[model samples]
Target: MSRTIFCKKLQKDAEGIGFKPFPGELGERIYDNISQEAWQMWLEHQTMLINEKRLSLMDEDTQKYLADQMDKFLFGGDYDKADGYVPEGK
Candidate 1:
């Protein structure tokens, strides 16, 4: 499959998704109530993304593109959006 499709599938899976009576929202709450081990793994995987390793399995260019997209998705918009930070180069 294409890289974007593969990435999309991974994103959905990460959020505890698949065929079901409802969507993954309930799974998210279930995960919130899950054991420490599961939460630890989740944090590790999140770190991998932050470290730009989650896209390491893909080709180099695709990895860079995905990394940029992730950066924008997680860190874009107004500088004062969060409780802190006026953002860089403002």
Candidate 2:
């Protein structure tokens, strides 16, 4: 049986990730509160942020920025988006 969590991002009960998606306390927090669907959403958003902003994962500052954005995306009720991006079929 799949586990369910009170997903913070979705603000609803949903299927939870089976394992810690990251290392350390943040991973533990996500495992406890984030849903699989929400995580997938974040992944898509992260891709957009990377591509639109030309973020290099090798850069420490970029890593920090992504981390901060992830926190806001999941928990802080706000997040950054690619500047001037329009959704497909919009």
Candidate 3:
């Protein structure tokens, strides 16, 4: 049976990730509180942030920035939107 969590991002109960995606306390927190659907949403948003900002994954500062953004997107009560992005069919 699949595990479930009360996803912080979507504010609903949903399927949980089977394991921690990151390597520290933040990952643990996510594992305990985030859902797979929310994580997937974050992945798509992260891709947009990377492409829009031209973020280099090899750069430490860029990695830190993305991590900070991830934290905000997940549990900080605020999520960053890609610049000039509009939801479809709005």
Q: For model 1, give the 10-residue run with minimal summed lDDT.
A: 1-10
In candidate 3, what are the lDDT values of residues 1-90, reduced to their tens digit? 789789988889999999898879999998999999989988988998998888899999999888889999989657677779765687
- Who wins the TM-score comparison? 2
As for candidate 1, its clashing pairs are: none
Q: Pick the candidate with the highest lDDT.
A: 2
lDDT of each: 0.36, 0.90, 0.88
Q: Is candidate 1 or candidate 2 better by lDDT?
A: 2
TM-score-wise, the better of 2 and 3 is 2
lDDT of 2: 0.90
Better of 2 and 3 by lDDT: 2
**TM-score to native of every candidate shown:** 0.26, 0.92, 0.89
Residue 75 local lDDT, model 1: 30
Candidate 1 deviant stretches above 4 angstroms: 1-32, 53-90
